[model samples]
Target: KSQEFLPPDEALEDPAQIAPGDWTLEQRRPWTGYAPPYAPDLNALETQVARFRRGDSLLVVGAFEPQEEEQPETDTRRQSMNPRIVDVRSRRNESRGERQARSNPFGRIQEEPVPFLPEEPEKTAPVQSGLFLIDTETGTHHEVLGEGPRGAFQLLVPNGRYIIGVEAFSPDDKRAWRDRHGLWQDPLVLGLAAVSDLLILKGGGNLPESLDEALPTAMPVTRIRTGESFKAAWELYGLRIGESASVRIGVDRGGEGFIRRLGQFLRVLEPDAPVVMTYEDTGPDVLGTVFRAVELNLPDLEPGEYTLTVEIELSGREPMVIARPIVIVP
Candidate 1:
């Protein structure tokens, strides 16, 4: 019998069809493209036998030289390539108006033209001439009137600290005149016994029996908690005879340079958290001893010191201003 030897390529096994423990490479077939499929059972058994030969348990394979876990690498440099996310955090702190101005493709927001209301003819006063005689000693007043062109008038009364006021009425029958502040208009004060001085009245004028001697008093709490309701009591002297009185209460962050108007600040910082105010009469009579109280609904404000400003608007005079310092704590 003749013995025949096969070539190395013919004797080599295909890696795809070989089992892990069954496949081996010889020196003659060192370059063979032969790799066996992975087998966990075969590897575990072989590891057990090796450990037993070394007088160790099979579980020691994981303890002595544990297989390292393969972790996929993440490329953070590639993730930071997006443009919008590059400086996203910094842009968040910008104000809404600033953001709107910056985001606008055109320079500014477009505004629409406002329509004008037609002007009506001015009404002249029906009662052209009126005389007011006030007795300073008794705080009493008497009035004399004539409906005609303004003319010189004379009144002979007991001479003792007396004041006389002349007034012209508007042709419009409106009972009340509003001041510049949209509140009840106060009468013009004319000094006593002056012949040369002329008194010019814009609207209906009255000779008050007694001047309003009461000054306004405001008592505001110094500190308030967030989301709490507080009362600001104001004592006003002499009459609540007006359509309505308005009180405006505003808050500002302390030490923020110049303080801004409440509406302006609310339009920027807390658009939804508006400056709230409520008005009520605490007076005994409609035309005497006016006592007013206002309520303020505080929002969730940051813990800090703040300045509170109160503006009281009565029959059309300049609004009275009151300011108080307050604190909000956690």
Candidate 2:
């Protein structure tokens, strides 16, 4: 009955030529050499439909046919199913120094590591509202009360060097001292005077003896004085960020000798006095007194203290170095 449903040409077609859809058992019977000994089982139709749903379509002619038996399993004890494991902990634990020593057994032993010490915090005096005097030589501190109007204060002590600083507390609890600019006096050397009005404090004694002799013994009455002395002074502008900050170095007496030796060369040092900016001729300015001023360009610098040094070279003598300290703020 199923063969009648197919066209006569399809029924009579060679089994290979027939479409898989029409290649029923009756059509494949001529190509297959074997025949079923039992009658067709109608109950197996459900099983065949389930197999087809499971992707086992009956289009393949001998797909379900029995295959030849596989060869017996071989026993090969010499072969390994997994890779061999290695314990490299000992080798990895070896230190670099040990490895180097192993490579060169006759080499000298490496130096022992140095112990590190934590940095100590800086100690600053607490801020207070009063007149405070610090003995620069002995580090002794003294505070005194104010006297008359304007909160005026006075201190009378034995002749010694002192650092006078005023401490004021801000609303935010921040303490600031009067150490900025030239407010703090240098070492004051007091001596006995016959008259109460006579008081003299030495200055510029720290200058190099050779450079000091080059200075004029007497001041010139005229505005313009001439000598071989070299004098450098630093003028500091504002230290705030984005502000005009610069250092003006005035070379008065020895302009010609300075130009001939240094040629406007200058060096900038860090607060620690280490040379950061090497010697570079900033070019010469023969205008009045041959003053050479360098703009600090404070915008690019971090907020901190810095030192600027000017080295004045001499033909047959060691260079005389002068340094000025400046601060920057954000």
Candidate 3:
């Protein structure tokens, strides 16, 4: 058998025609005497060229012509490769059934393995009524629950002093704290310890310098010359039965004369109660201006209608009251 020889330059010019498995060349070859050269070992051929046994076809590029097929509509919102529409409504409906399967009276979910990539979640954490932050140092690791990804972000740290600091760098490209520490040679430290049952949290996403130092006492309530009052409303859910409902009142805008204390008769008649109420406070700067919450439980009444009443009190002034009726079926 004889083979045709072509230089590497000629092979490069029309490599398609000379390349093995060329459909056009194979068709032209005399079928009677022609046999394919010894087949190259695929393992070796694959290293230099792709392991394609089929003939190569040329993709013709015509003149710059308009596309015959209309370009598919591009939806920017649908760009996500793995798109999913989550209907929280259906999940909420099945949530009850899922919860029944997982939870018992002992405050523990059933020992079932978590599902793999569940489309609709059946259970979620019950929404709480107040801000409650678990103390990280207290060795208390409370599991956060809720449907949203950021559900656990609102936890309130226990009451205590906390050092508050913000990230900063000196203009000279050095850590300000580190430079100061090097100069003093004394260990630079920020004190952070929680008091018993009380947690102090640093606000504005800042670390503290000394947890031992209390936050500057808010300006006294007597600083404001003119005492003012304002009406506020809140919706509350999940009031355990027979729990004391004591709500602190505060003004949203007043400078100093805010914070009135008032609450409904506390007593829960049934399990899981919700209510809406209105309260009033003297201006800002009072104790009630910033945090105004109430706690109440009406035990005598069966799990049903609840009319929440708010009585706002001001310093050296007559008490102004607002009443809002709330109903809790379950």
Best by TM-score: 1
Q: CA lDDT of 63 in candidate 3?
A: 8
lDDT of 1 at 112: 32
lDDT of 2: 0.25
In model 2, what is the error at residue 114, expressed in angstroms?
Answer: 53
lDDT of 3: 0.22
User: Over all chains combined, what TM-score does candidate 1 have?
Assistant: 0.27
Best by lDDT: 1
lDDT of 1: 0.32
Give candidate 3's error at residue 275 in angstroms: 16
- State the lDDT of candidate 2 residue by residue for 1-330, as single tens digits: 011112225333322222212322232222221211111110101000000000111100000101122333332231222132222223676774565345321123322311111123335432222334555556665554321111122333334444343222221222121210001222212321010100011123333232123122111111121221222222111112222212223222222233323432233222443433333333222211121222222234355544335444333333434543333345
* All-Cα superposition RMSD per candidate: 42.8, 45.0, 32.7
Model 1 has how many clashing residue pairs? 12
TM-score of each: 0.27, 0.20, 0.17
**Candidate lDDT values, in order:** 0.32, 0.25, 0.22
Off by over 4 Å in 3: 1-288, 316-318
RMSD of 2: 45.0
